[model samples]
Target: MAVPLLSVAAPAPHLIGDKAYDADSLRYWLAERQIKAVIPSTASRRTPYPLNRRIYRRRNVIERLFCRLKNWRRIATRYDRHASNYLARVALAATVAEWIK
Candidate 1:
């Protein structure tokens, strides 16, 4: 994700990800290119980190997407063995949910 997004977007950019991507090497890499990181500090972080509350609030959208996906029994159970079949089912579910919304 970092490589592809960075490749297309110009001048390097601020990246927002959960604590999973928060690592010393990743921070240094982003800083090297002048990307303002809004990543939050994990409990294991040794140094204090500053983050924007407004940006963090957007994370709820991803949580909602997950909850929406979980509504599909096939997805929740991983019943499909093929990737394309699974993706198609997910797309169908997402489309119907959007229509209802």
Candidate 2:
């Protein structure tokens, strides 16, 4: 899913992801496209690359934002079947969350 999504989207200089995306193949693939992978290494890796903890800390902001959005029952659950409607609900939720912030 991530591979296909990255392929379709306009190339970004950097890609940030969680440990679940810490595969060597994925890192190599991103490197091939000149995308800097900011994913932390999994415990299984023999030798881990140096990761920028300061940059990785920024992921918390996004995580917290998603947490806030999920607090809305409509957005947390798939109440709206259509993708357009679902996206609108997400946008509305984000707008309301930002306003409240």
Best by lDDT: 2
Cα lDDT tens digits for candidate 1, 6-98: 657776356778888787777787888888777899998788589988877877876777788888888899899999999999888888866
**Model 2: per-residue lDDT, tens digit, 1-101?**
78988899999877889999998888999999999998999899899977888888888988988999999999898799899999999999999997897
Predicted structure 2, TM vs. truth: 0.92
Model 1 root-mean-square deviation: 3.6
What overall lDDT goes with each candidate model?
0.80, 0.90
Off by over 4 Å in 2: none
By summed lDDT, the worst window of 10 consecutive residues in model 1 runs over: 3-12
TM-score of each: 0.68, 0.92
Question: Which runs of model 1 end up more than 4 angstroms from their true locations?
Answer: 1-14, 29-36
Candidate 1 yields a Cα-based lDDT of 0.80
On a 0 to 100 scale, what is the lDDT of residue 93 in model 2? 92
